[model samples]
Target: MSVMIILIIVSLFVASGFLVAFIWAVKSGQFDDASTPSYRMLWDDATTQKKINKQSSNHKQKSNGN
Candidate 1:
């Protein structure tokens, strides 16, 4: 039907728009650090913070209890 043909054309136009935007983003370095975020998150920042906090709290408790 004519309606189906028009729908297909409209869908293609929208998909191409998205494709162009994706290409533009890639060229602009938007995807440059895509892998780094995944790996960086695997490095536990909380552990280091907790260690520092524990040391500081221990020092404070020792200082105040004396």
Candidate 2:
């Protein structure tokens, strides 16, 4: 039927759009840091908090100086 043909055409277009997006993602280094994300959760939260506090204190000092 004509409706089936139209459905097939629309499906092909949708599939191609997805394929193009996937290809673009691969070329754009989106997957380059695959390992980092998986290991990031294992980092110590205390260390991160300390670093953030230090940076904020530095910023505050600079603002107070100006």
Q: After aligning candidate 2 to the native by TM-score, how far in Å is the CA of 13 from where it should be?
A: 0.3
Task: Provide the RMSD of all predictions against the true structure, rounded to 1 decimal.
Answer: 3.2, 5.4
TM-score for each candidate, following the candidate numbering: 0.65, 0.64
Clashing pairs in 1: none
TM-score of 2: 0.64
Candidate 2: regions farther than 4 A off: 44-66
Positional deviation of 46 in candidate 2, in angstroms?
4.7
| lDDT string, candidate 1, 1-66, tens digits | 999999999999999999999999999999887688877765668777889999999999999999
Clash numbers, per candidate:
0, 0
Error of 2 at 64 (Å): 28
Model 1 lDDT-worst window of ten: 38-47
Candidate 2 displacement at residue 44 in angstroms: 5.4
| CA error at residue 54 for candidate 1, angstroms | 5.5
Q: To one decimal, what is the Cα RMSD in angstroms of model 2 from the true structure?
A: 5.4
